[model samples]
Target: MALMITDDCINCDVCEPECPNEAISMGPEIYEIDPDKCTECVGHYEEPQCKQVCPVNCIPFNPAWRESKEQLMDKYLRLQADAK
Candidate 1:
């Protein structure tokens, strides 16, 4: 599953730079995660970096964009290709 930044986010600006896929960004009121670009750091790290650095624990798995580990890996591969 992709991760989402909840309203509980303190906008501490810690999560944005931590995303390996560059999926986290500033929204109108807080940080937002792009489901299309989010692979939950499956291919890049053992865990989601944003969640790891989030001081408030506001990042959570997005149920609406649920995906399996294999699917996330596929997305990560696609993203890597696109970056080239």
Candidate 2:
């Protein structure tokens, strides 16, 4: 699943840079995750880097954007291909 930044986010500015897919960005009030670009770091790291660096633990799996590991990998591959 893609991760989401909750309202509980402190806006510490740590999570955005950690996202390997460049999915996280500043919203009107806080950080937001783009479900289209998010891969949960499946192809880049063992864990979601945004969640790892988040201080408030506001980053959580978005049930609305649920995806399997294989699906996440496919997204990662597509992202990599698009980068070229």
Candidate 3:
């Protein structure tokens, strides 16, 4: 599943660099996650790097973008291919 940053985000700028998928970015008022790019670290790390570094614990699963592990891995692979 893709994760989203809530209003509770402090904009401390800690989570962006931690994302292996490069899915986090600064939004109008806070950081945002690109669901199309998010893979929950499926093919990169064992856990979500953004969530691990977010101090306020504002990053949460995006229910609207619910995805299974296989789907996430497929996305990861596609991203990897695109990067090449």
lDDT of 2 by residue, 1-84 (tens): 998989999899999889989999999999899999999999999999999998889988999998999999999999999999
- CA shift at 59, candidate 1, in angstroms? 0.5
The TM-scores, one per candidate, come to: 0.98, 0.98, 0.98
Task: At residue 54, give the lDDT of candidate 1.
Answer: 94
| Model 2 spans with C-alpha error above 4 angstroms | none
Off-target runs (Cα >4 Å) in candidate 3 are none
lDDT of 3: 0.94
Query: For model 1, how does the per-residue alpha-carbon lDDT over 8-72 read when each residue is reduced to its tens digit?
Result: 99999999998989999899999999999999999999999998999999999999998999999
| Per-structure clash totals for the candidates | 0, 0, 0
Query: Which residue window of length 10 is worst by lDDT in model 3?
Result: 48-57
